[model samples]
Target chain A: MSATEEQVDHIKQAVERWNAGPVAKLLAKFPEQRAKFVTASDRQVERLYAPEAATIDRYAEKLGLPGEYPFTRGVQPTMYRGRFWTMRQYAGFATAEESNQRYRYLLEQGTTGLSVAFDLPTQIGYDSDDPMAAGEVGKVGVAIDSLADMETLLDGIPLDRISTSMTINATAAVLLAMYIAVGEKQGVPPEKLNGTIQNDILKEYIARGTYRFPPGPSLRLISDIFAYCTEKVPNFNTISISGYHIREAGSTAAQEIGFTLADAICYVDTALQAGLKVDDFAPRLAFFFAAHSDLFEEAAKFRAARRLYARIMKERFGAVNPKSLMLRFHTQTGGVTLTAQQPDNNVVRVTIQALAAVLGGTQSLHTNSKDEAMALPTEESVTVALRTQQLIAYESGVTNTVDPLAGSFYVEKLTDDLEVEAEGIIKLIDARGGMVAAIEQGFVQKQIEESAYRYGQSIDNGERVIVGVNKFTGDEPPTINLFEVPESTTQRQLDKLRGVRASRDVARVEAALAAVKQAAVGSENLMPPILAAVRAYATVGEICSTLAGVFGEFSESTN
Target chain B: MNAAVKPRILIGKPGLDGHDRGAKYVAQILRDAGFEVIYTGIRRSPEQIVDTAVQEDVAAIGLSLLSGAHLALFTRVLELLHDRGADDIVVFGGGTIPPKDIPRLKEMGVAEVFTPGTPARQIVAAIDDCLLHHSVM
Candidate 1:
């Protein structure tokens, strides 16, 4: 046999000998040999990790980092050595003024950028005073009813100084407009304002349900933003095509990457079809992914995504710009991994996942709070989470080198394996017309559901052990200090909303809304008029309702 | 379906808490043990959830809340169901519920309060028991 064949033969012989010898001989040496093996019930079999067939070098050859094309070893030659990943934390709660304080706090604490979390009404396009906003105002995130809220949220924070990332997909254009209005008020030109908007709407239909318009109209709004952002905010990232929420909604690492990239592709194809050159906007396109407890898998996913995106941008789209070829991303550690049983364990999980993101070559990262499962993170808990990132960046020697696991046999092989698997999924999506069509057909959602089901089965069967959840039993579920939103914050927000409405000219708001409605129907970009409406103090709900009347709402397939 | 059969439970989130990890985990466990589950996505209004339960014709409705507005939100949902004459949907809850509030919640006609670390099997058995005692399936 050849050397490779000889190694395979040797492994087979060893497996056969182990199966037939030792314990077998010992069993034969005793009367209970057959009984010993038979007594072992089917229960243990369910917990075993044996695949139908074992590959050569489970961690070495196929999964190796550098050996793989589209290079998952660390997307670039110098990952952290050249520049540490951006520390972006999602922060926003209660009213605009309150959230602005938190935003400044996060920045003072060494956060590289800002990621805004809009409250329910704001996300669905409603003002705080709207009946729909009644019990929901500022419950989960900050309420931004008008440009006044946006101004307070961005108060004193220089738009040109620090990049801001907003997690608003449904009402992205309006929020983007508000962001621009803040930039204008600050005397900073739109081109100088840098940041990103989580404007990926397809994922909304598939995972997060904050969508307002039907798919076609949603695409039009998204494309409108894409066209406007490239021209107005040249440095700003238009859409953070996301798979992070998809994974948070119960998906595997592979599905997260596959589905997210599929969504990104959909956005790219849409923009390209909208008469924009691939190179013009592809460079500004960004991605957001979830970092789960799977260390190797998560790391492999980043590397795989980078490599896949590079090739797709170059070969598929025929993009010539080097920046367009690189898929810059922001990763948030999975909130689902945090267990309320022993919430402290979440610190360790976030730390590990954060390290994986850094090692995998993310452009930015967000480590979720340990107590997020229970409530909004307490200041103490948020500090601890922030410290987790600081410590990794400062103390961990892992950042000293570029692609620390670069030439490792196992990591390389795993990266390659992941790339191949993800590519296959992409091809499957391509055959079915792409992400938009695939999502409509329920392909992506079904895949995530299956993986989620399998994962749950494994956890229940003890194959996947969530510490303190399924394995270690805690006596008295330790008392966790949960953060409570102050009732006064709501009153303050409502007061502010009332004051802004009282001061702003209602006629101006009407004209702005009318202009927005006209732009929604025509080929004109919506951001400028939307900003005009925001400046006129039009409620977020009013602007969104206008678009809804034009675009319509989306009701998803239950299946 | 008779009370002897496994009581079908529809656990759901009735608002914009994109935190569905707990609900999804519970759904899988309930499904494996044989319970029909109807999951309403994030940002669902209280009325939508109640409408879904009545339409799906479920026996029990388990509202999961990680957002701290459980007291207000759940009460409104319950009140809506009562107003609509669908109060028969056995109401229960889970998710980040403080221990002190459990009794208050139970007093509000919530059949059970499942805190974190309560085993999946235990939840299944509890639902079964609650359905049998209440003579509703």
Candidate 2:
């Protein structure tokens, strides 16, 4: 509802009196930190927010009740009142067996879900023993070469009980197939398995650069997964259209939502063009985002994303299912914001980010370890990170009520402003023939590059303060012992790969790969053949290379 | 300050690590600092890095790795330079290298190793110092 002129005048008078009296007295004793207060995205924060500051014309239309159209408040009707946000800590490193131990440890520590982190070699579709995988066998995350590794990775973990999320792209199909096979081995049907794979490959081209194939083939593979999972694994999220990497690569909150939804638009359009019903597959679609340091802005970003996505699905695509309209998402704390100097300061930084995620209504969250800026976090550090979420869920009173910050004038204004700005960017992308074509023209990459460069310059010039990093100088050697993968890990992985190759049926492996190549050349879904190959114990490198021979590899045109 | 003889540097990312924000930022800052910079985009092998260094005839090589493969990748690039008779090129490394590994990286013929929180000016000054010392020798 619009404010009356008399009410506006009264608010103005009160603000003026407050500013002239107490504000002036305080300013005389101490000065403001900066002349202008801005958000992480450079949006100016007003001196005071009031009824006039809100941009909504009618509350019912824009800010409807929870679980209704344009779900701005939250997705679920009783968010956090029914249960707290899922505390899913992303942990994986070293061999599959070792990572499996970590997963069990987290589960025993009250982790609600499992999020797997694959090593670089596995992420880019290389086998552990490949020459390209040397010195990187298990450096960043767990190494999974075939069904044996996948089996070992999930040895004791109950597949039907625990929902797992794999942070894998480019090779998502292969890993998904391996996951399905492992479920079958555990006497669980594909329909009972539930999880999310970071199948958003366009972001890889724009932000992460872990892409293996060109855009055309990559989109085809994703389309195939959407079709396959719709029938085979109905409970699983087919694609987690991710903004986490984009934000980590240094995008503003609006850009994170803007580019992410743009990519989602491209995927939805691609699936629709492939003759799939929108309601059939869109229900399982989920999102992943980054929760940075800005409290209100981050919360507003999630709200804006939900509202914007609901409108897009309803108006743009004519999706009838209410499930298709709700923008469910998982959030991870921003790793780039952590500092190597004064590493303990990262604990405070992570607390702020995790709280932002929880307050923003994230469905699941992964809080980063404080020692991550130096290396892979140790077990002690990871446990502390997990306990940070525990403290918020059990101890903090923020989760007691739903949308606790709902009526704040500043948050509401920020939400409206960000929605409009992000819609403007999405319109520009739609004008250029959607995100894939835009990425092909290097437009998205250039935008992120400019943003990252500007942020770096801000730190370089002292315009932005990173606390202990650029200010509050300190001199202390790191006291925490980093978790280091033994150099023998590579040798051990190679030995296991050899053992698998010697034992697996050679004819079955060859036939499965041949089928994969043929499907790559044809219009058939590649998941079945890929699953067959994975079940036959063909290495990831073999299947990927076969398809690469048909679909070819991608090399980015230097910007 | 002559334009014709600006010290050329090759900024390359070795291995499958795709985090190129630091590499690209350093490239731009080096270019802004009046040096010719050529960037080999992500996922360049060690041979490709050294080959590009020789082919471009760059005065120095700036290698960035965030995948914990800095020791192996950096040493391979240095060994390749030595093998190809391009040992005069000043080599430096950056990106998430642990503090303890910095001394070992320096001992392996890397002119310097810049960790996180390093200013671009400090890196540019290090490159300048390396070129000055090389020219004097």
Candidate 3:
């Protein structure tokens, strides 16, 4: 064995002794504790483990290096060694102007990329002045009403230089159109623009609730974007199949992988069924996951997901390109793990979680602010969150090597366990006639619900200890700075929207809307007409309302 | 204490946050602890929540939120319950509620603000106590 392997083995033995010593003794004394250790899927588990048997072989065979099928080690061959993961910081609040400043601020901070957070109105495809948008227009995220807002949001930031990620769904096409319009104004060609639109709507139905139309219409829009982006802007990732929201909503690491992959496969099936080749679009498909407090579990989950996805793409879809099989994902630290009780503790939690994401080999990461449990992270807090990642990359030795935990007995075992459990779920999802059918029947939602409930029960029963929450109670609470949207900013945005409306050719926008409606009803793709509307400076609300009229809204079925 | 009388609770999201992690986790624990849990998926308005509570006849309503709009959302739901004549249903909440807002939530007729790390059994027992005391179930 190499010296590194010898050291890994030595550490593994010590860990085994430690687990058997205290943990085993504890388990022996408390027979009831065994039940708590077991996951919802009932995997044989101890609180901690040593790398051996099932895990080591799996790691060596699967997670060896990148550019290989079943890419368990890293997605790209050189990983950060070739190019560092995109330092995409999630930003945006209130008006486009304020959000513009924040975007510029982040860019100046050496942020490799920008991720936009849209308000509820924009997320659900409503104008800032709409009745449904009252009190919510600029509360959570930036309110993008039209091409005007998009222009202001990307004001000084050159489209050619920086890749932007917008966290929008439901009205993702409308937002993407506005972005494309902005790129056109900036003298950047459609093909020159590179970014991602988080157009994952299935998760909206299952977890997030930002959906405007029902599942049928939602899938149509997603597939349309996939088909459109494939032809128009091949570099753009049309959809970022998200497990982050699902995991944040209280799923186990395994459930996150299972449900997320299920969601991705559903999208792929939709696109292929819509008449796109598997390899043509699969390479640009990206994923988003949550990095929680469980370091090894989170790392293992990533490796297992990559391996499982590669196998699925190769074996199921018969994809020939190795890139098509690679599971390139973005991760954000779990917002659910942050606590408002002892707000300061969240910083430490986010740091640890960010470390896990780095160790797990995420393509990009966004660390949650400490005050996120209370409100949208303040500018200072958000900066701290960014610095947390910067610190990990610069100061921590973790980023120096690929899959640093590769040979660890415990990590390997956990990876194997996660794979077995997640694969079992994927099989069940397949057996149930794929993810869409499973979602319609509440199978995926039901599993996530059960896992979430059990985790809550554990914390309640003292089996799982959330520091400064269930245990480690604090007496003195620290005062925190909170971010708030000014009502005046909303008014300013409304006025700017009005000015755009007054200047833009009204007849042209009407024509554009008519074209979008026609395309939506017909078998034609919506992106081109949507782009036409965007070029005509059609308002986001108007475009969405037209679609809503045709596609109708989604009313979720109850339990 | 009869085996036939399993404690039933309705865990739900009463607004547009779309985050159901806490609600789901709590529901799972209550199920393992032997309770019937009905989880209504995300974007449930205040009126819908009260209506679901009355129809399901749950002992308590566990509202979950991660979005900072809990104060506005939870209060509106409580007010809706009062309007709908279902104010008798025990209402408690769990999520990323700040310490400052806990007292406010209580004042707004929330029985408890079960913040992070509060044991699931404790929440379950609290519901049982509320149901027994109010004689609602």
Candidate that would win on TM-score = 2
Model 2, A1-559: lDDT tens per residue? 2356567668879999999999999989998988898888778897888765233446766778788878888889999889888889888888888999999999999999999999999999899878888777899899888899999999999999999999888999999999999999999999999999989999999999889999889999999999999999999999999999988887889999999999999999999999999999999999999998999999999999999999999999999999999999999999999888888889889999999988889999999998888788888988989999999998999988887777788888888888988898899899999998899898988888888898899888888888887898777766777778888888878888899999999999999999999999999999999999999999888989998999889987784
TM of each candidate vs. truth: 0.89, 0.97, 0.87
- TM-score, candidate 2, is 0.97
Better of 2 and 3 by DockQ: 2
A409-487 per-residue lDDT for model 1 (tens digits): 4554556666777788888999999887888898877777666666666666665678998898678856877777777
What TM value does model 1 have? 0.89
For candidate 3, please provide the TM-score of chain A on its own: 0.92
Task: State residue A165's C-alpha deviation in candidate 3, in Å.
Answer: 1.0
lDDT of 1: 0.78
Worst 10 residues of 1 chain A by lDDT: A38-47
- On lDDT, the stronger of 1 and 2 is 2
Q: Rank the candidates by DockQ, best first.
A: 2, 1, 3
Model 3, native contacts kept: 0.49
DockQ score of candidate 2?
0.73
What is the Cα-based lDDT of residue B17 in candidate 2? 93
Note the DockQ of each predicted structure.
0.43, 0.73, 0.41
TM-score, structure 3 vs. true:
0.87
Task: Rank candidates by TM-score, best first.
Answer: 2, 1, 3
Q: What's candidate 1's DockQ score? A: 0.43
